[model samples]
Structures are given as C-alpha cells and as structure tokens.
Target: MGRETYTGDVAFEVRGHLGMITLNRPKALNALTQLMCESILIQLQDWAEDPTVAQVLIRGAGDRGLCSGGDISSVYRDMLEHQPRDGGGLLPESTPSYAAAMPAEEFFAVEYRMNLTIAEYPKPYIALMDGVVLGGGVGVSAHGSHRVVTERSRVGMPETTIGFSPDVGGTYLLPRSPGNTGLHLGLSGIHLTAADAIFTGLADTFVPSEALEELTQQLTEHPVDEVLPRYAKHPGDSAVEQDAEWIDAAYSAGTVEEILVELEQHSSSYPGAQQAAAALRAKSPTMLKVALEAIRRGAQLSLSGALAQEYTIAIHALRSHDFREGIRAQVIDKDRTPRWNPGQPETVDEDLVAHYFTPVPGKLLSLE
Candidate 1:
C-alpha cells in the first residue's frame, strides 16, 4: 500500500502491506543496543494492533549479518560505571549488589520483553537470518513464526565464552534442540551452519542469499504461503544430526567434568569430540557449569519460566569477575586469554552454581 520509513540504528519501513525492519549497523555487524531493543518492541506492539500491516519481515541492512549480539561493549561499560571503580573484587560476595538499578538491567528487561513479543506476535513474523545470528540475534529471529536461514547463516549462543550463560530465552530454545546438540553448542559457543540449525529446530525455511531480495519483493505482492514455496529449498543433511551419537553420549553426562571425561575418552573416529572438549576447557569453568545446569533445568521449564531464570543468572553474571575479564580479553584487549576465577571446571562448587538460580531481590523478570 503506502510506503513509510523510520530511521536510526534500527530502521523501519512499510512497503506494500509488509512491515519491514532493518538492523542498520553494518560496521558492528548490526549489534543491538538498548534503544534498538526498545524501538523494535514499540514497533511490534504498534504493528500487532494495526490492520493494514498483513505481516512483518526483519533483516539486516548489509551483507555482514543479521546481528552479532547485544551491544555487550556498552553493557561492559555500564557495568563499570555502576560498580566499584577500583576494579572490585572478583568473588560474587564482593560484587555490587545492584542496590540501585543500572542500564544493563533495563537493557535486558526490554530485550527479553521484545523476545517474548516476537514469540507471541499475531501476524506472520519472518526473520531473514542470513548471516551471523548469535545471542540477541537469535532471540530476535529464532522465535519468529517463519525463520529463514541461508547458506551464509551462522548461528550459535556463544555466552559461555564470555563467562556468561545463554540469555534471551536461549535456555528454552537450545535445550529443545535435537538430542544433546544444544548442550554442546551452549557450552562450546560453536557456530552452526544452515543445515545444522534446521536439524536442531532453530530455523525453518532455507532461502539462498542471492534470492532474498526477489523473495522479499514477492512477499510484498503476495501472501507468505504463496510466495515462500517458490524460494524455499532444502538445506540438505546436517553434520550435527550425524554426530548426534557422540554428542549426546558425551554431553549427557551428569556434570561438566564428566562430560569432558567422556569426550576425552571417545574414539578417534569422532574428531569433533576432542574439539568439543578443548572448546569447553577454554570457556569459564563456572559459567560452563552454570550454563549446563541452566540448559538441563530449562528442559523442564516453559519459555516464560526459562526467561525468568535466565534473567536471574544475567543479574548475577553482570557482577562477576569472569564476565568482565572475558570481555576484556575477547573484546577490549583482544588477548584471547581470560584467567577464570576458579580456573578449572572441577573446582566450581555445586553451591556456587545453585547460587545463580535464586531470584534477584528486586529485579525479577515478570513475564506475566
């Protein structure tokens, strides 16, 4: 019908009865910020009530990716602003209690709410998950009714590598992945190709990257059901599906240490097994345990429950030493080496892991 446009880091347009959103920061891989999350949430709410908008389609502005993740560098800076300036103690007890609210709190609250909105959208919500879709990107895209992946799509929840567990409802989505593949991806922060994403139930249709523009044009002129079939193609067999046997066997172990032991003892035929073990060993030991527990607990909880639990974990993690250190190594310093608090998975106590699951005093995520 009528064409309209809204600008900023997140741009919005209405084109021929289609609601279009583009994450516009190509240089940073369209990394989401607090304002971006709020913009998306408000637009989704408005569109949900609008009669003219038949459907919604979201994609990135450039060829780099849909989104890298949340603007974690901002979150890191915010945490610094609110915490002790003398590089506060690394222990959980010595961390800031968040006596007053912080931007990080509002950021995640808005983001998780945005995720829930996408999940419950009334119209056909389509996400062109073309390239890098990790963390917050996955939250925005994976919950949509129509998740379109391409040959270039690379998906994962790489939270553990940052000394954090998966948030953005990742615990709910990844835990339901085929067999224990979710556990492997969560703990290792490994990227997934198109076929592997479909195999794990994270993506729906496969559309070639080159054909996306034409497909969007078709969508504007016709309904999705009529337009999708012409462009959607099978992604073919998934390597993750084939490796499920060893993946499941190793990740199914009771604890992270046991899982590592299982991986180390696996036959040479499964080269991936050893690689996974190495990946896990490199991540923050406490977070690895916390993430594994979160996934296991998430399997028994609903999406809302998992989101609530993840919120609690996020609050605690923000105050953690490893989270900051991990960010410094990976993002700021580019050192690629983080000296974890416990330094070893076996040293992470069950009590410390359990501590993360408790409710945050005044900051509970109210999904109801």
Candidate 2:
C-alpha cells in the first residue's frame, strides 16, 4: 500500500508488487558508484525472498541508458594520487583490490558481488537497457533474467581502450558467445546494436525505446512473465553476425598476437578484419593479453570463479602506467590518443601478463 523509502544515486521503491530501481545519475550517464552498487545489492537481496515483491525492474534516468559503467573518473584520480610504497608493486591487499585503508577498494568488491547477486537471483529481474549501455551498464543489464534492449541501445565493454580489461563477469559472458566472436569483440571493444545484442545473447528481447515506459507501468499492474511477452518483439537483422565467419577464423588463434597475425594475413581480402586488427593494435598491450586470458580461463569456470579472477587482474593492472594514461587521454584530457607504454602487443609477454593473475593478500571474491 505504501512506497519503500531509499536515498542516493540509485532510487528504489515498490510499486504494487514490482520492486523498482532507477539509476538517478543522468548527467554522469548513471555511472555506477559504490553507494549506488551497495543500495542495489541490499534491495535486491531483500526482494529476492519477499513474496509481496513479484519481480524487479531497473532502468536509468534521462535518455542515456541503464548505466555507463563504474565511476572511472574516480578510479583515475585514485590511481594518480595513489603513492605506492612498493613503487607500483602490489598494495597491502587487505581487500581484493587494495589495502583495507584504500577507499576505492570496496567499489569493485561490492560491485562484483552485486553482479553475482543478479546472476543468482531467484526471482525475475528485468533491466531496461537503452542508449550507451557500455562497460558498467553491461554488468547490470546483461545478468538480468529478462534483459530488455531498445532500438537506441548501444552496448559494449570498451575497457581495453582505457588500458583496462573487461570485468564484472565479462569473462563469463563473452566466452559463452557462439564462436570466436566473443574474443573479437572483447579485444576490439566495438559497440553492438540491439539486433547484435540479441544475436550475441547479451539481451533477450527488443522493446522500442518509446514503449519501455508503458511496459514498466504494465509490470506494476500484472506479472512480468505475462506483461513482458506482450511487449517483446523482433528488432531486426544483426550486422555483427555478417562478420561471424571472419571473427571465427581470426580469433581462433590462441592468443591476441596470433589473432592479429591472422588478421594481417587476411587484411588484403577482408577490410573489416583488417580494421578490427588495427583496433586491437591501438589498445594497451598488457590489457589485450589480460582480456584474452580472462575469456579463455572463464570458459571453464563458474560465474563466481570468473569474478574472482577479474578482481586479481584489476588490482594488479593498477600498477601499470597505461591505465592512468588511458584514463587521462580518454576521460580527463578528452584526447583519443593514449600512448600505451608497451605500444606493441609483442612487448607484453606472458610473464608480464602472469603478474595480473597473481593473488593479493586480502579476501578474493566468493558467492559462497
């Protein structure tokens, strides 16, 4: 009979039996923060077992979409101000990412945990993913039981552009793609349209951007299982699927370097593969290797296991110069040119990539 009370960037309330969550940061593209993440986690955890709450729905304010990703500006600032006593070596590792004292440490730890919660949630979890659903946006919406994408949806995990690997269970999500398309997308950081998202299994159904509000209202009135089917409709043909043959062949190579070599050999015939190869070439060498390894390893592991592995990579990657430089160029400086320290992929050898997998002192991620 009464609406639930909540405060912070994430707005939560109960409309009838529908538990509603609105990402309140329109200007920031609803970029996720620890507070937003924690609020979401708590509400979802409570609603999961509440019989009165029949389902959950999450969306973003403004036209931008569900969420852009984690607060990378804060992460960039932290990296700049962080004076490592060990000289870019590992921090104390009181937690998964940093020493217990570090404020940013809890961000991913909680965020990853929240992602896991959505993945494991028993009740129906619906996400209204629209407009610029990249990085952190993918994490929130991709795991939902009913992932609703719009005609305006533009989704991708473009972390490699900023010298970061895809995290928040990307390792699990990417490898599950039908073919080497996952590897190609992971390495290239290209955005996918609504049709592409459904083809790639990132989203379930397509609902027009204008119709989403009506759908939400319907969810409050009827069961999601009933209301969703009424609105779900086919978007269109996917352009990403056109390149499936090339992606399978190029990304079939075990490593990013091998993939690049394959792309290079075919560059004369397939301009698309050539362009994909060039995009990979422009990304951070260390991150390319890390992203490759993450997906490869994730194929064999559970969702929780993948999150744990990513936690290790994110913390270790903080030591690298590319992360800070990538952020400066893309976020702070607004320049597209990020001068990667090891510009060439060849320079980032296996040993260097191994450092990211090395565990820290504090507790790692666990759904159990």
Regions of candidate 2 where Cα sits further than 4 Å from its true position: 84-101
Residue 56 error, candidate 1, Å: 0.4
Which has the greatest lDDT?
A: 1
- lDDT by residue for model 2 (1-368), tens: 64866856988889888999999999999999989999899999989878889989999998877888999899877776664422332344353345533456668889999999999989889999889898888899899999999899998999999999999899999999879877877889999999999888899999988899899988987988899889888989987798788888888898878989999888898888889988998898889988998899999989999999988887776656777778889998988998886778877667778878888766465567
**Residue pair clashes in candidate 2:** 69-136
Tens digits of lDDT, candidate 1, 1-368: 54656798999888887899999999999999999999999999898998888999999988889999999998889777766534422335433555667789889988999999999999999999999999999999999999999999999999998888998999999889988999998999999999999989889999999999999988887888889989989998888999999999998899999999999988476999989989998999999999999999999998888899999988888777778878878887889998888889878777888888877678799876
What TM-score goes with each of the models?
0.96, 0.94
Q: Which ten residues in a row have the lowest lDDT in candidate 1?
A: 85-94
lDDT score of residue 79 within candidate 2: 75
Superposition-based RMSD of candidate 2 using all C-alpha atoms, in angstroms: 2.6
